[model samples]
Target chain A: MNVPLDPKTLVAEMSPVSTSEHIAAMKKALLKNIQRSAYVYRVDCGGCNGCEIEIFSSITPVFDAERFGIKVVASPRHADILLFTGAVTRAMRMPGLRAYEAAPDPKIVVSYGACGCTGGIFHDLYCVWGGTDNIVPVDVYIPGCPPTPAATIHGFAVALGLLEQKLKAETHVEAAGETAALPHPDIPYALRVRLEREARRMAGYRQGRDIAEEFMALLEGRAHTPGSFTLLECMMEAIAEERDPRRAEIIGHLAEVVQQAIRGEAPRGETP
Target chain B: MLKLLKEIFRTGEATVKYPFAPMPVCKDFRGKPEHKAEDCIACAACTVACPANAIGMETDTAAGSRTWSIDYGRCVFCGRCEESCPTSAIRLSDDFELAVGSKADLTRKAVFTLADCACCGKPFAPAKEVDYVARLLSQSARSAEEADRLRLTASTCPACKRAQDVHHIADMGIARQMTQELETTP
Candidate 1:
């Protein structure tokens, strides 16, 4: 039953003074966080620059990460976090490693973009040095071909929390180090339950599975029959169209080809 | 130690369920490669800009043109190709979970097609490129005197013609898609 809305009764039940004090303390902590500041330096061994452009925009007026006391420094010495972009190339390995080392003690490394995560599409190129994991001790891995600005910001926030937790335990605070292992969303039940003799495993559903198989089939032409569309002809169409370069909707343009190929209705060789 | 164990027990476990449940990437996290075909002008800007040489392109001269091939194995995810793209035909996205069993299975391709010229039976490019350089010629040539200049006798070879045809249709499509990459969308 709903109780009558009364400030006096609400205070009596809620412990208003204690609640107010707790809020004040939390506010004070948040303000303190903003004052201390955190420095992040971005390193681009060799990248397409799309990721770099986003990184540039993040520090701009609109996405100003400085509001959260996070600033991108140009030099590694002043940085608390090392932001690495692109796939680490043969030439870049030394510099990237040096950059990580220069970031001072209590430093963390955050590899941004899929290239940094696993060398991305360039996984086995001649010059590729693999992912950042091959080179140094990485505290956090931010996966994406090139992470969006919001994701970059949020990742840094998560890194900041990790830093705090790491430090708390360093001085003998004795907190659980693996708390991040099980995220909240993965757990569906509101209440905890004891496990039986055997735990049940649910079935799994996948999204990229079908599309990936279809794409691979088209690329290899493993499913193509005689007189069917050739991979070369498809490649020809892509090259010719790209020459005009609208450069605006490239992703959508690619999607169309992917869709057409998946349907097996892609235009055959040529119409004379 | 007892307090530490109690706090850990109280919070329960935080392991992400695999296959069935995956961790959500942060907002703006770059993941997979997504193409904006409408904005792409069928230009090979992204291909030319790629440092890892992951992007491969082919152009069919007569019917349709412009094709892009991405060899993920060769892609460095440096994103240089996306940035240097004069038409901004390519972009790196926020998808990271792109693992496959066969290494050869990860190559991706994209395409664009263009219409041909009705009068000359040649593909000059999309009508948008020159807004029908050939069509305007056709209309003005109604008079015998103007017919000489109006007639387009240009016979591009098979390879060149196919390339032109693809660009003709693709320009309109790419123009729509690469706007963000180009940064000049009206």
Candidate 2:
């Protein structure tokens, strides 16, 4: 899985320039072609802006990918690569598809994070419409609720390998590290807890008709008696099982209670 | 091609010898905020100006406005705090080197000593700023009274200081800034 950029035997891009006089002019053109070939455009369908922020940090001073001639362009039409973030919301689906189509042939699409990859944990929601692969051909799928700048670069390194076949790179140049660029001496405990919680929610598979029926049933229910609640309330309550643990530990507690209840242990009471 | 290969081999390493030697980041880059407590008059202006609610004045009711806290964790580093400080008390510095193990650790705080006003004999601004201004206006005994009377703060009742917001001062002492004439020569 190690792919490296080897500039050796670089396709003699100038057709071997028949005469010695044209050699100097030919060399300049080849170098220009090498630099012109790398262009990436980032697209956010409806992301919460976490992945976008991380992606922005990547191009900054610390991870400066411009060193490798990779540049971030604004327009999708002029791009050679599509770096997509967010779960494909219903509104942005068509525009996202059009953007992918507009990026000319021989373009690479990188699914930027867990949200873009499998709809992440927000898939069960009503607003989210599709995962990344539904609309475009995704070449690389980065895993994480909002993949770090390092993870984004790691995915990019993989994409470069697929774009150009090559042997091992001599120096093991790893992707960007945030510790050096970040001001703080340590990753805040709050952020760590938040990211870890997101990791747990994106665990289940999709169910088409059955899921819709259950969801509609939840919407269509009304129970006024004791020990009974509306379907939406029940669904909202059930969301604990599917909730991304980053913000609150409430759903995680419910899931833990359910697992404990099934295991025949007396469920612990909620925090006051 | 052979010459290009030789050039590549001869090129120095790209990686910076960081930790041991840090790379110089661009000036004006928002990394971290540095506060100068000496200049800060404890106005709570930075707190009110901060859009993110990341900066605020934390104080006990009895102690009055004691400490100013800037939550770097929530701060967008918008520079609004620095921009709004009338005394230029808060200034953004090049030192962006901030990292924390906990969110609470990111909050920067400053506190000042309290002092009573020269005229009203009431608790007004911080001891040092009040003393410094008192010393400066000693020449014009009336200006010291003007400064003390006009020493407005959140504690100052707005109703009483309504006219004295410089209009009264202009009529009594300093002249008001000129209004533009209809036909002005540039």
Candidate 3:
């Protein structure tokens, strides 16, 4: 005899597994009076394992997540908390669901890392489901590329309701007459651009901007102060005082650019 | 046992009291990207440079406003946003305890008004950005008249600027023709 099968059961459903109201109440109760150690079972939904490394380090002697009795277990059957990592790739979705199902009712789900929290840089990829919350109900999100061990501990505390979350949603509206202050208004715009470009070329962007700002401040201070030393002499003195050879060299290059501007000479390789 | 206990005492505690006491992060630690909206021009440089698309800007032409938002969950803490910011308004701070119970709490937003184009009277760029550019150009201008011209150019929309350039180029062509005719006659 031929058997008829339900097409709905045959096809893999894309909908997320929903927890019942009873389970939600139990989970809330569990969170409220969780006196025992919460055993965490890490489910790798298709992670790069950066989060795994950080998680392991959090349990190490330095961070010592075990101090709060947060233990990482190998089996989902023994888990009170299911820690999901990665963006939940298509192939691993079933396994992730399986791990979630294996854990007993009232289990807290923690979405770990940038990938697990929001699919990170790979959110738009074709094969990934984007985030753990897309596949399961996430109770807590520990967001970082891979959170530092201390951050991980903080996340665990938040998950266990032992600590209050520090981050709150904020929105700022622009007021009337709001204006961004021009950096180094004392320096000529052309000279400022040239100095910043030279400094950025020598050092990286963040450090370069910092160095340029410092150099401009020094220039402005020297100009204001009635000193016998000329601008060039002041720069040389500043460079001599700089302990770091690398920073000294960058400052020297910036000074040369300033000298070029003063003398009406074009920069070395480019036309005026 | 006594010797082991003494050795342990000598070594001191290695485990940090993190949640109980404030954890000290190292200097230059890349953690949270704090956006100072007061100093931000909403230039969209950080939005373009973001590899994760965590920082985004939504422009509402009808409302004449631009909304700048950053989702901390999607941010990789790479500091690219901090590096690409023109006004140094976005900087990475040491506030890394960013775990949250809800996803909505992970987002930060800023709303800025758009500036009307000087020529067209239509909203083109953010008001703060236009003001900043105008001020910068005027600061570098050689003469008062030149400063005024530069400020006008900075405030004009890109489309209007292009149209003005074309008209100016046509006027220059007519002038060049007149000069050529006069030189040939002489």
Candidate 4:
């Protein structure tokens, strides 16, 4: 039997926690002379539990984060690293702060997943504080919807100064006379549109676009060659060469679309 | 103890050599969205399609520039940007290692010049986008005159096009009324 804490007593206005100069100096010193294993404690504020699953997976036998002496502890009091996951909700903000305070001095705070990094898709939510850094100081940010096991390990390594951060801020400016090239200039735009639409209707968006591009490339290659072989023959040859039945069927359907365009006939399911 | 040791030897190692050796990801892994600014038209399609508002565009009309930005921290790696991109410019690449020490390092930006409208001389759209549309229309035009007209239409802003449409409709109405009057008199 446990007594629940009163919500009124827990709800109080407090400023963001700040580390003093001594704590900063101690953290730097700890990073430099750290010889022992770093224990991690996961403090989930208001995550969807996707980050938690990945975190657990990272410590499993397959990823084995324990190989680097990183252990997930049950209590923040025993933690050297605090892995914060979630977009800090108003309700959980106090508990999150308490966990941060519970952790000893010279603690490394690693913000895990996209939500923890910048509140992810829930950034604009009414009750969300946007990110973990909005409340507590974050040493590193591991950005992904739910970071893979490898990414989690990499983030830990970055937090412990075992590896350098790979991403850097970059800005690209448009050069003088810069222009985007038209895709498939040789193919008729109407025909290209029809082919793309039919492919997308048959397959999914991404796969359909890929298929349409491949078909156009083949058509362009054939047009460039000095052969008298008709486009139908070329398509038939392509269909015959394709090993995957599903891909072959899609290509066949696209070829039918091309044929319909060539014959000047309106596609099916529409009144001319 | 001997039997347990034998079982452990038979089971072998299950751990992966990650952070040292390259980890192989699946083919359809939704990783980082790589933006090719060179190929991008800055049409704001990705910005509009982004569910998390991770992709954004800021149009500076006074400066005649449009800045496109994506915050990897806010990005959910949903591939919506890749799907909505018309130019095939933004794509989801297989690079998922996006940990950073600073928040600023998680942002990527591209600045594109804006095109002045042919009629109003105002910065209306990205120069690359206008140029791409004009070329695409010209390529599809049946005749030289049609191609020229289509090119002009692409370069004109929407407000100017609407104004031209109103004038053209008024002229047609006057012509039709005069023709009806002449026919009735005869």
In terms of lDDT, the best-performing candidate is 3
lDDT of 2 by residue, A213-238 (tens): 23334333433235666433664565
Query: For model 3, how does the per-residue alpha-carbon lDDT over B16-117 read when each residue is reduced to its tens digit?
Result: 888889999887899999999999999999999999999999999899999999999999989999888888999999999999999999999999999999
List where candidate 3 sits over 4 angstroms from the true fold: A1-13, B1-6, B174-186
What are the RMSDs of all candidates, in order? 26.7, 27.9, 3.6, 4.0
The prediction achieving the highest TM-score against the true structure is: 4
Q: Which DockQ-derived CAPRI band holds candidate 4? A: high
The TM-score, computed over Cα atoms with residue i paired to residue i, of candidate 1 is 0.33
DockQ of 3: 0.85
Model 1 docking category: incorrect
Fnat (0 to 1) per candidate: 0.05, 0.00, 0.90, 0.92
What DockQ does predicted model 2 obtain? 0.01
TM-score of chain A of each: 0.48, 0.47, 0.92, 0.93
What C-alpha lDDT values do all the predictions have?
0.52, 0.54, 0.93, 0.93
Q: What is the fnat value (0 to 1) for candidate 1?
A: 0.05
Model 4 misplaced regions, further than 4 Å = A1-15, B1-7
What lDDT tens digits, residue by residue, belong to model 4 across residues B37-140? Answer: 99999999999999999999999999999999999999998898888888899999889899999999999999999999999999899999999999999998
- Which model, 1 or 2, shows the larger TM-score? 2
lDDT of 2 at A269: 47
